[model samples]
Target chain A: MGLYFVAKRFGVFLVIVWLAATLNFFLPRLSGDDPVANKLMEQASLGGYAQAGIAEMVKVYNQHFGLDKPLLTQYLNYVGNVAHGDLNYSIANYPRTVVDMIAEALPWTVGLLGMTTLVSFALGTFLGALLAWPGAPRWLQWFMPPLWALHAIPFFLLGLVLMWLLAFQFQILPIFGGHSPGAKVGLTVGFVLDVLRHAVLPSLSIVLVSVGGWALAMRGMMVTTMGEDYVTFAEAKGLRSLTIFMRYCMRNAILPQTTALALALGQILSGAVLVEVIFGYPGIGALLFQAIQENDFFVIQGVVFTVIVGLGFATFLLDILYPWLDPRITYRRS
Target chain B: MSETILRVERLRVAYDHPRGVVRAVDDVSFSLRPHERFGLAGESGSGKSTMALAILRMIKRPGRIEGGEVWLGDTALSGLDTDRMRALRLAGIAMVPQGSMNSLNPVVRIRDQIGDALADHGVGLKGRALAERVRDLLAQVGLPPDVARKYPHELSGGMKQRACIAIAICLRPKVIIADEPTSALDVVVQKQVMQTLGRVQQDLGAAIILVGHDMGLMAQFVDRLGIMYAGRLVEVAPIRDIITAPRHPYTRMLIESLPSLEQRGGLRGIPGLAPLLRELPPGCAFHPRCPAATERCRSEKPAVRAMGEDATVACHLA
Candidate 1:
């Protein structure tokens, strides 16, 4: 059973990656203008390529970018280039390859965003469980709504507000960028401390912004699971409240969240794209933003494809892990 | 003389709903002696189930025991906090709930679930002794010892009920409450399950409270019977008296409605639905349906009046 699940999920992963890449190839260019036209318009306004006529400019740009070739040829070559880790040069950053630029920014974003998402989800679930506990303090009822209200506010607004209060006004934390201006990057303890210090505000902003949603979801799930007859039976069996909450209620409650967690894993990658940009963290979201502005098609495609692949892989892992957690699930073809 | 194991005095369980304060169990009281089989017989919405839940302090949101003192031995169940109530459950007063066959965890093997009950109660026995005890419990319920290794879904319905019974009685508490324990089984299987329960009680000397709607089954299995209607016990009597000489008009109708095998006749269902608690008729809740209801019965509620050592009837005429 385990082997079959793993194999099926792997197959799904491949299909999802292929579909994402195919969609990426066309969706960006479908906005009723050719890439060369946008490029010509920009360059013409700058007077760098005004001497060239529209037709001639299109031809020259196409030849330069290998778009002069047939569509099939360009697609096949692009696929080959991707496989060989030879993503083309950025149109905006004429000297930098798409692969190199994304590689430079990927780890920073992943480290900051990934760690924060996990921490916030755990904290929210714990707090929600506590709040849902019978005879919880009256103060918590007053406290939870504001957190939920904060969750409804967009990430960018929250990020800007935090930046204004904590960074701009109070001068309590640094305003922008991933690291301090002169901080050295090395295997030294001082370097690690500087990196963490820089990370603290951005991580906190993202965590506070997202934690309430998880808390609400988990608490709702706990309430529903608590109503299940088995839970009532467990309580009546004279099990300790702590044991009943953890063992029976949590086991059942956490089942539905497994699917949510699977979807969240995919979301966690791109869900904070705006926040990463706002904080000036060197993550993929910021890289993608920069690449899009530069009309670096290769880099944009690479980043999107990579995100899709990561999401696919996470979903694959979810499919395999769920049955282990919930023994009641049986895989059958309909 | 049998020792009194439970005493519910002037018990009333009500729900504070938006419609009104609805009393689901109105001024009900009963006492069960040690080693007695006391059956509570009533149809759905009769409040017998509510009374059972109230006794365990398991009545959830909206429903509250407004006025009552449920004494299990000497501990007042309504007054006990959640922690004490939990400790009292299973170890002090075990229950076999309705649809209990579906209550066993579908994924867990039967033995592990039983072992969990034992372990949670801190029984602390292990190795051959634990295994022997589990096997003995399984055998006592008429299931083969090997069946304990299987999941609930793998077992037949009757076997699942048996497994539930085994789990209920595993700790050997003084009182066992079986709510519709045999309702889901075929007649042959029902008899077998009831007989198994009888053997267990005989061996352990535990007081039993069997709650079901089937008067015939209760009559066959229980020593005393309590008849409930619209959230109140309208009558309480020994099995012989309740079956032979029922006093309440509703009780007489219910007993008369039963189809006797020896008497060749079609069974007659009671004429009207039981009165809703929200819009109970003025005076006696059953007057609207009772064929023998008088003008006074329609105007004033009846109190349960003493009749004999074994019986009490709630009716204006009585």
Candidate 2:
């Protein structure tokens, strides 16, 4: 059953990727206005070429990019190239491959945004669990109103608020960028610490906006799960509060959050686009912003497809892990 | 005289809802003897289930045991703190819950469900000992050993009830409250499950409180019977005495409602709906629906008085 589930998910995933890439190839074409002509017109005078020379340049550009081929061949070649890790070259950042751009941006996003997403999930779920616990302290109840208010703040507005308080007003934390321009980039503890210090404000902005959402979701799930008969049975069993909370209540409640966790992890690729743009964080989110402004199709396609693949992969993993966590969920069910 | 293993003195449980306060279980008092099979027979909404939860303090907020003293042996259950009550729960008194189909955790294995009660209540046994205990409990409940490897959803209704029974008896508490334990099962399965429960109680030598609306099943399974109406206990007597000759009007109506195999007629349902506890008439709570109600019955309540050494009834007529 497990193997069947894996194979089924893998097959569906391949089909989705093929559809996305095909759409990527056709969508640009369907927009009309020859891209090569546009690229050449922007860089050089089109009137300088003879009529045959212009056709020759256009054909050569299309042929070099494999765009002159039949749609099927182009799709196959796109799939093959993607399989080989080639995401084409960025038009805006001339000569830099999209793969290269992604590689450069990934570490920054993972370090700051990925870590913050995980921190939000972990810290939020813990606090939420505590708040939902029947025996939880009354003092902890005071945190809910503030948490809900925090959660209601939009991502970019929060970025603005954090910058205003910590950067503009107090002038304590750095307002923008991943690191000081003068700081060395290396394995040394000093350099690493400097990078972390600069990441604090950007990461904090993302965390503050999202943490409350996870906490609220988790608390809601806990409330409903607490109503299940298993919870009452657990209480009736005379189990310790910790034991009951962790084994019985949490085992049931955490299933939904695990799914949320997977989707959130996939979202880490472009983490908080506006916040990254505002802070100049040099993450994929900022790259995508720059790509859109320049109409850098190659970069946009690469980033968007990567996110799609990431989301699909995360969902596949969740599908596999679900039955393990919830024994009631079996692969055989229709 | 038989030793009382569990006792309730003036127990009252009330729920505060938006509509009004409902006195779900009002001033109920009863006692259970060792090796006794006691049945609390009541119609739907008669507070039998609420009283069961009241016995264990399992009622959540919006509901509270307003006035109560429940003693599992000597310990006053209502007075114990949360942690102390938890420790005393499965060890001193356990429960075989109603809706057996849902009582066992669906995701949990039968082994874990049964073994957890043992381990959590300081049984401190694991591996072979735990497995052996699980197998023994399963066997006692007439379940196959392989059931331990399966989940609740994998089991049948009867099997789930059996598993719940095994869980209840795992700690061998002084009293096991089987609240409508067989209500959700078919007649044949209910009989089998009841037999399994009866055997488990006998083997463990523990008392049981069987609460349900099925008067016929109570007459067959329990030694003593208590009848509840509008949150109050109207009759408490030996099962044979109550079944053969009941004193309280509600008790008589309940016995009459049971379809007798020998009698060729449709079932006799009591006339009139039970009064909402929130808006019960002044005086006797049962007076609104009582045929024997008089001017005195409408103006005054009746105290439960001993009819003899073996019976007690609450009625001005009695």
Candidate 3:
């Protein structure tokens, strides 16, 4: 039954990825503007070429971008290129392939956003479990109002306030880029610390806004699972309080968080867009925003495709992990 | 008489509601002897299950043992701290919780959970020894050895109940509380589960307090039974006497409600609902439904009195 579920979900995953890639191929072209003409107009604005030179430039640009081919042939070639793991060039950036731009920005997003999300999930779940523990400290209840308020605020708005207060007013954190402006980039401890220093503000904004959600979700799950008869049974069996809380209640409580973890991980891979933009951090969200503004259709498509694939992969992994985490869940062949 | 394995004297458990205090087990008392099966037979909300939970100190918030002295062999259960209570729980008195299907943790395997019960109480079994004990417990409860590897959901309702019985008797506690253990199961499964529970209890020489509303099931399993009504013990007698010659009006009513082949005139349910705990009727608490209730019965509370050898009743008429 497990193997069948794996195979079935894999088939569905492939189909979703194919649909996303196909949409990437045609949706940009359907905007009713020719890429070659757009490029010509761009150059004309710069006043570099005369009419005859501009015409030649357009012809060369069309061929260079593989836009000179018939639409059907281009479509087939697009599919064939994607099939072989080839991502063609960015029309707006000229000379840089869409894949290379994504590849360059991917690490920054994954590192900062990935680290913050993991930290928040871990910390929030632990705190939430403690808060919901029967007869937990009364003072801990004071944390609820602020956490609820934080969770309700949008990430971008929170990021703006954090930047203004922590970076501008207090001057406790770096305000721009992923590293010190003049620092040499390498494996050196100074460079790594500078990078981490720059990251603190951006990651903190995301963590502050998102941890509340994890805590609230986990606290709710813990409260419900704690009431289950098994928990009482555990207590009745002379198991210690910590044992009942951790093994009986938290074990079941963590199941829902694992599912949320997969989706949250997928989301962070797309980058903490507003946080990145606010801190002037070099990440995929900033790159994607620039591509959208310039009508770099291929770059936009590439970024979106990456997001879609990440989400699908995360979901598939969760589908497999869920049953293993919860014995009450089982797939039926029927 | 054999040694009293467990004793409860004037146990008063109540829930503090916003409106008023709901006396769930209001000044109720009972005792169980070694290897004796004592059943508390009552309708829903009669405080039978609450009384059972009170003995183990398992009642959640909103409910508490207001005034009670519970004794398990020699230990004073009511005064023990949480740590001592934890030590006394499975090692002194185990519980087969209601709806055995969900009594075991769903994420854990059957063997591991049984091992947890063993390990928590300082049973100290580990490795091959632990596995052997788990296998032995399973076999004692009539479950196959391979069931140790499977999850609770993999087993049938009867199987889960049987597994529950095994866990309850694993430490051989002097007294075991099987609260509605077979209620969720079907007839055939209930019979099988109860048989396994009965056989194991007998073999281990454990006293059991079987709490349920089903008088027929209680009669079949227990030799002595207590009939409860509105948080009060109405009658206590041998199961045969309670069935053949009940003293309390409520006991006769309960027997009348049961569908019997011998008394087959279409089951007659008693009139009126069980009292809401927060607003129990004055005096007898059953005067409104009792055929023989008088002004005296309505004005004064009746105390439990000896009727005959091994028979007790709390009704003034008796």
Q: Write the per-residue lDDT of candidate 1 for residues A26-130, one digit (tens) a residue.
A: 777676556666767787788876555877877877787787787778778877776687767776666778788878877787788778877887888877776
Give candidate 3's error at residue A49 in angstroms: 4.3
TM-score (chain B only), all candidates: 0.95, 0.96, 0.97
Using lDDT as the measure, the top candidate is 3
B108-137: candidate 2 lDDT, tens digit per residue:
788887777777778878788888999988
Candidate 2: list runs displaced more than 4 Å. A43-63, A67-73, A270-272, B17-21
How well does candidate 3 score on lDDT at residue B99?
61
Q: Per-residue CA lDDT of candidate 3, range B183-277, in tens? A: 87888888888888899988998889898987889989998999889999989999998899889998988887888777767768889888787
Where does candidate 2 chain A have its weakest 10-residue lDDT segment? A43-52
What is the fraction of true interface contacts found in candidate 1?
Answer: 0.43
Number of clashes found in candidate 2: 0
Better of 2 and 3 by DockQ: 3
Candidate 2 DockQ vs. native? 0.65
Docking class of 1: acceptable
- The whole-model lDDT of each prediction reads 0.81, 0.84, 0.86
Model 1 alpha-carbon drift over 4 Å, by segment: A26-70, A80-97, A332-334, B74-81, B100-102, B105-116, B124-160, B184-192, B279-283, B299-301, B316-318
> Which is the better candidate, 1 or 2, if ranked by DockQ?
2
